[model samples]
Target: MNESNLGRREVLDEVELKKLNNIRQKKLNQMDSFEELSYEQIMKMANMHNEILNNIHMSRGDVYLYSENEKLELVEDLYNTYMSDFRDITLKQVVDFSKNVAGVEKSQDLLIYDWEKMYIDQANQILFDSSDIGDLNMSLDKLVGDVKSDNRKMFKTPILLYIETLKESSFYWASVEEGGSGLGFSLLKKRSPYFMSNKKGKKNWKNVAIADAQGMTTGMLGVAAYGAWGVMFGPAGFALTGGAFVWVAVESAMASALFG
Candidate 1:
């Protein structure tokens, strides 16, 4: 575990962690039906333009006409639909990279199961592999798709996607590095190997403690970035750090992906 100073950032503590999860769940429960989703809330949820989304659904009032299960289905349908926004870091953008990206053509099980470790030995048993940094970057960008089309387009709420899902699914399981480009969140299953083992009672808890602390920073920054820190954390959640969780999540990949 001594792999070059694991981390040094602060993260949410136990009480704050519980709060983050609870608030996130509440957001989901409140969405038991999309009937309640407001124009503003939708705006907050999606970073991309919704002109296409708006055309498909004439009005918000029309959304509630569907039955309860239909509401969830509606959300899923929207979740699955691609708005074709140009900023989308989609598969089509890097189709050419398929010839060069490592593991780009491998089966899904193999990709996720291997902890998404990049092929370090791409030399082909040949000397001087000449791949550049751009090659590595392209390989990573398209890695998150649940399917080919959805690879780079599975954009969803940062509130629900990153901090919301990971805290529960990972069970505070520490990650020395992020698993992948956060392809998509699994509503029905916990991600494998991401939560692979428990490190309870490990002899050296320094790294664990450091990881947890940095996580708190992420969570705190998350709510703030979600623009709900004031509402969810309230005066007390703010006081915990004498205005806790107010720090910007500018660096949160999950938050920034959906937010910025």
Candidate 2:
């Protein structure tokens, strides 16, 4: 393309980006009026997400093995009984358990978070990077094998977005469970293929957290929104999860639990 053509393409890209951003912002605004959640509510939100997972048959176990206030005597028995369950998820106990079970190193204690990110990043690279098989090409099974052989998370963007969608769906499911509002699982269940490509439908979120991060899907923009927080007040948007994919549930517009 000529320099003039290149300049035009860049302008087009910028315009497209702005349009996507506006759609995302509108969806995020829905949760702005919600109040902050309490500690017990946080626990319930997390547990409810796990319960949703159980119903879906994605995983075998259920959550909520430990309560918010409890004296846990650390012992072989404790480890044997609850290690499989991530039972120490309430408040300070979560940190303490991570430190104990994951070992003494500071990074080691945050291994679960690190591991989750590592997988997501790798998936994004593999699906979106354009260097690998997905030049809109195929050969994912081969690339997956290479991750163990060469040891890398490689893929293209759309596929990575897909991995993100599956990861975020649980939290959205929990939001409706918490009485936040919107369509919840009914909405989320139908949108999985859309985020992978406009041909399939639209965009959506890949994460959810209450703190300084973001997830959830945007049906309008067709691109994933992450790395920012969209707060959900009251019993909605589980706080312990660490980010917010705040609102968004579809294509014409992203729906979510209306706060305030």
Candidate 3:
């Protein structure tokens, strides 16, 4: 071959080699992630996931026969168990779980928040309207319907809000459970999906957390003052409960100041 032709051939070979290397690197990363997860870790994730799923189903009725305090501990234990095992969850793992274990077409089915969208939207609207307590409870009951519904998208905002709320006040669930406030515990658990997504490393963790916090706090005080917490937990009930529930009281006071 002429010198010019030889040089062109070398350039083409180099480009092809680079592409092959990139593909190999991707496969290596995938294999490493798979091998990094132990059988115990996989079982742990699956067990916790199943617990959450059962909780969602139980939330539909009075099947949870334990005292409010017991329920609180149950939820906290579940959170700790899941968080302790938090690792980068891959799409392949989720798919495998869905197909092999859940017998569902999509992993999203297993990830659903178990609540209805219309109820959440309506309850949120009423919370900001200074509505009567009866109305708020009624709306909540409607939102947490019997059958498991698939609305993971609708839960994103609520999960983010709950995370921001929890990050600011670590003992929120404990306080609610101590105070025997079933409504509060149920509300706190709504943030489960955010943690699930975090485990999977779906987005920039810092960015997702900050955005969730900002979104939850933004204009929250103004709307909260309209008797949202009060309606949900009863007049002065949330304020009386100390510890993590303090987040609610603080926000409620700020909201009261803003909208009053």
Estimate every model's Cα lDDT from 0 to 1. 0.26, 0.28, 0.28
Candidate with the larger lDDT of 1 and 2? 2
Worst 10 residues of 2 by lDDT: 1-10
Write model 1 residue lDDT over 14-59, tens digit each, in one string: 5754564466446545433222223233223222222222323343
**Which residue pairs in model 3 clash with each other?**
221-255
Name the 10 consecutive residues with the lowest summed lDDT in model 1. Answer: 121-130
Stronger candidate by lDDT (1 vs 3): 3
Backbone clash numbers for all candidates listed: 12, 23, 1
Could you estimate the TM-score for every candidate? 0.24, 0.23, 0.19
Best model per TM-score: 1
Q: Give the TM-score of candidate 2.
A: 0.23
Superpose all Cα atoms of candidate 1 onto the true structure and report the RMSD in Å to 1 decimal. Answer: 22.4
lDDT of 3 by residue, 112-200 (tens): 23443343334344333423334433544444342124443332323223232323221112223233223323433343445434433
Q: Could you tell me how far off, in angstroms, the CA of residue 150 lies in candidate 2 after the best superposition? A: 1.6
lDDT of residue 170 for candidate 2: 27
lDDT of 2 by residue, 33-94 (tens): 32323424433433433333334223222112222221122122223333334443332332
* Backbone clashes (count) for model 2: 23
Name model 3 segments beyond 4 Å from true.
1-120, 128-130, 146-148, 151-260
